[model samples]
Target: MRVAVAEDGALFRQGLVLLLEAAGHEVVACEAGGDPLVAQLSTIPADVALLDIRMPPEPDGGLVTAERLRDAHPDMGLLFLSHYAESHYLMRILEIGTDRIGYRLKEKVGSVDVLSDTLTRIADGEIVIEPELAKRLVERPRSEKRDLVASLSERERDVLKLMAEGRSNNGIASTLFVSAKAVEKHVANIFDKLGLHADTSAHHRRVQAVLTYLRSQRGDA
Candidate 1:
């Protein structure tokens, strides 16, 4: 797939370009700053654009670039790459309502195959959320005396615990000795129990929920 990567770090940007190129994907454009990225994307259209959540000039400049691109070229897939998987940052991108969006952690960039597959999936109209984000979604509280997991069955809770540990649906299935479809169903149920509507953008809420859970756990200690 043809991709354009916009990151503030020079070394990281170059590293991404090299990784993508090595994986037999085209890196049409790599920019270290948001201005150059915006200007470049104005002329060079790509199948996917991977942007950092925080870029120079403004901490949220990359998000601005993403919004602009979504407004101008709705067909192009946008992916947010970040060091910290803050739920609010992911939510802001989903509010744009563009399909084929992705949110991945920067640490996962070590695997070119996974990155390539995620880019392809995002371009092909899949949400392509990271497992970490999915875990956060499972921990949120939806109602009085009911955390997100309260509505889940025993099987669903097991799936959610695995998800929090960064297991994919297939991985969860393998561990539970069930089919992938069962894992998917459990995930869907978890989403429903959490009151995460059909907005196609729940990454931020997931992060927030996880943060809240972690803080509470620490406080209890």
Candidate 2:
């Protein structure tokens, strides 16, 4: 896939370019800040654009740029490469849009396999959230006495967390050392318990389940 990158740190930007090249992806544009990248995208074509969540001139400049890019290039994939896993950041990224978008930690996404998977998922219009961020959101303490998530079993919660991380059933099964059929059963149980009917497609239900998981973190459901 063709990719454009916007990062202020010269060393990290160059390393990211090298990593993308090593993965056999074309690096079309590399800019030092969000503004330049936004300008470049007007003329250059890229399949995916990776932006640092925090960049120069403004603390959240990358996010600002992402919103603009989303408006201008609705089909292009956008991924935020951040060093922090703060809920506020994830919330902001989700506000931008869930489809063809992702937020991943810089430290963890350095792995070639993880980076490749994340980019591919984003390109395929999946919401690719960092697993660490998903875990933190899922494990955070909730103050609500009557919680819907509390009704879930331990294993169902595990499957739900992976679902929030945008893992396929096969991937979740691989991670949890279970068969795909078992993963499907757990996902079905989660949907039923969460009151998600089977009227929708399984993919739509999966997305709804993940959104439910996110809503629970804020005591909204």
The candidate scoring highest on lDDT is 2
Best by TM-score: 2
Q: Write the per-residue lDDT of candidate 2 for residues 1-221, one digit (tens) a residue.
A: 99999999999999999989988899999999999998999999998999998896498888999999999999999999988877778777877987899998887878778789899989998888988888877766365513657888999889988988888898899999999999999998987877767767777767766776576667656
Error of 2 at 134 (Å): 0.5
lDDT by residue for model 1 over 129-194, one digit each (tens)? 666765665555344425545767888878766655435577779989999988878777776775
For model 2 the local lDDT of residue 214 reads 74
Model 1 is weakest, by summed lDDT over 10 consecutive residues, at 212-221
TM-score for candidate 2, residues paired by index: 0.89
lDDT of 2: 0.86
- Number of backbone collisions per candidate: 1, 0
